[model samples]
Target: ATAEKFRSISPAEFFYRNKEIAGFANPARALYQAVRELVENALDATDAHGILPNIEVSIERDSVKQYVYRISVKDNGIGIPEKYIPEAFGKVLFSSKYVLRQTRGLFGLGAKMVILYGQMTVGEPAEIISAAINSRRIYSYRIMIDVRENKPIIVSKGVWPNNTGWHGTMVKVAIEGDWSRAKQKILDYIKRTAIVTPYANIVFKTPDGEIYTYLRVTETIPPPPRETKPHPHGVDLELIKTMISETKAQRLIDFISEEFQGVGNVIAERFLTKYGFDPSKDPKTLSKEELELLVKALKEFNEFRKPRADHLSPIGAELIKIGLNSILKPEFVDAVTRKPVVYEGHSIIVEVGIAYGGSIQPSEEVVLLRYANKIPLLYDEKSDVAWKVVSENIDWSYYGIVFPAPLAILVHICGTKIPYKGVGKESIAEVPVIEKEIEEGVRQVARSLKLYLARKQKEEEMMRKAVT
Candidate 1:
């Protein structure tokens, strides 16, 4: 009875009172994810302004013995309104659908966990200063918690005292953790981010006063992905139960028939008929056995099709240009957008691009291997079977892909579903269907690279002959 009673309380409430319940076995991991959340926010602010975004990041170490580190990200983009400040900073598990496209933060829970983690480990706070436009007014606040009770505590609130009307948001975080490991992670994140978001100008200042800046080379931003409306093709029993429980209508059949229209009714009717349910009968009159049968039927009918256009995101060609240009310092960087490659007999659609020229060494390839869902698949080439097609099948000798040379390649893959190896979130598990297509895609990329290399070789040979 005690165990049953203890389980009765809500999980959210339990975790709310115990912030540490989220777990921070490695503060660096948490901090890495936290910085990702902030950088994404800065990008979103830029997109909102209809202008190319510029961001500056700085890291400083303080209180040497304690190793307190301050990391700040400043963006010249569209700043948030005063009304959204509380909800954006305080709340957890909030979904914003103001824009319909699929994004990394649909739950709006990305950075709040950061704030909670900071309050737990650092004993300091996260600070934010911002203004919506060119106005001299700036709203600043520090986010903390009432640690004794695990409640939110506002540490500071004010406008910028300098009176120099800055027009963007600056977020400063002070963390009491190991800065060395965190520094490497931040650098890697910026490098990867540059490859993906080539259009944005990025500047990073490290704790040692070293700076790395990537300036935008192009004005184009990829087109926004299409929005997804609720589809009725699939609804498992658990999902159906939640939907029915939250629905305004009392009768189960009534809610299924009325609340869900079009394909939803058809699916519901099919599910009910399969399980010997009577569509004409009111769901409230059903017995426990009948309800159980309904749930089983619904469970069997849960296959869904995600909208395709909703999968695409605007990846500026400039991002590729800037990344390869900086890393390889190539004399020329050329990026080609391939139409969706249809591999024979496979349902998977592979879209790929590559940059080659100047001093691109074999080790310099920064392949942004993403699944169809746009989640990062951060696996090394050796583990991923896909690399086999690129390394073995392609002509590497001419491309300078010798023992330890650097190569710069960015590959993005998308489809209805991307099968991953495991929860470790490493490589894509090989499926016969997708593998064949990916092989073909790699062949095409290899052919392009080979042709470009051939041209360069011929030109160099001709020049040498002329000099002789």
Candidate 2:
């Protein structure tokens, strides 16, 4: 390999050449991750509009192709608009998720990567059916990616009037997959997603003629996360430059106050005076060096209020308990939602739930179910910070928890930015603040379980005394 071999490739082409980074490594994992990405997109669509989600997913072997499976997911949520549908599904890194919000998908490349995989493996175009909310027309397209150009090649397009007044999105793709290797994980992902989102009705059909349904237990869903400006902390110089270039505000003082969260005009004025910058100077006039210095000052000023964490929505504690009860059917269940905490200027909330006894079959250790932004983490358990907290920071004996008992613990972290270890988004890195919050939340719910167990023990002893 030499410098002469280097050539610039489009993002789509790069990911197509190296699909494993997007979780499309092998036949087994590819099938599993395809379902995960599609379902995550489905939920995000519904959650954005507070729509009661009704989703249907199915995977089956394609009739003529060996080891090729057809994957289809349909959701009754707000549909993709007509104009952006091509790029949204066909191009790489083109998505609505590149904003400040609590969403299941952080990287915008996942779904399109799945589409790219399908195109390369099976030589098939993606089938899309969508009816956006704004118009009374529905759209259908058979499209594929021109990876070298990062553009969508529309094989065919169809549009018709919406007679049923339905609005949602459905995407179908056929790809080479091994359904047997990851069957259990596929099922577990769906079930855990249902547990976390009690308001979503999920019906999943496996390739082996099995059907599982998770109906909506509650009609309520969490309010959509507000789209606020970025916090001043942990911001880089490039983003500041972009904000300055795009901002409509004329004065530097107004730019600073308007662009960042919690930095009012008064603070901006004081910050400008302290930093020896002209407050009335045009924001767009700042040089790269000056912008760098401004960012440093913002981080060190220490007078900015905490990021507005209330704008982020967490799966409430009541819904947590209800979802766990409905799924685990345990004898005792409790959940705790901790107050919001900031990590690298991103607001995060950790919610923990514990289910003990009854139908929960335990093993040598606690069964840890981890989630981030409501998407279940099915792989990489031990490396996750949630696992680290449960195994090391928490003392199970102190909470009356014993081995070989019916027990399960749930840890969910909702935030504007999830500290994922990789593009897989399967595990969280151990930030001190996040780990502490998880440990504290777990202990709170563990205390409730311990009290319940202690009372149960006392009742058993009293019954024995009466018998004597």
- Listing every candidate in turn, what is its Cα RMSD in Å to the true structure after a full C-alpha superposition? 6.3, 1.3
- For model 1 the TM-score comes to 0.69
Q: Distance from true position, residue 345, model 2, in Å?
A: 1.2
Clashes of 1: 14
Off by over 4 Å in 1: 1-31, 64-66, 95-100, 132-137, 146-151, 159-167, 231-306, 316-323, 331-351, 364-403, 413-440, 459-468
Which lDDT tens digits does candidate 2 get at residues 1-468? 656776899999999988987889999999999999999999998976799999999998977776999999999889998999999988899989888988888778878988999999998899999998766999998999999999999999999999988999999999889988989889999989999899989999998889999999999898888787888885888888889889999999999899899898888899899999999999888887898899899878888888888778899899999999999999999999999998887899999999998888878888999999999998999999999888888889998888877889999999998899989888999999999999999999999999999999999999999999
Error of 2 at 466 (Å): 1.9
Q: lDDT per residue, candidate 1, 335-441, as tens digits? A: 54444432221123454445554575445434333433333444344656566556554566655445444444555554333455642234676566555655665
Say which candidate scores most in TM-score.
Answer: 2
Full-model lDDT, candidate 1? 0.58
Candidate models: Cα lDDT each: 0.58, 0.91
Worst 10 residues of 2 by lDDT: 1-10
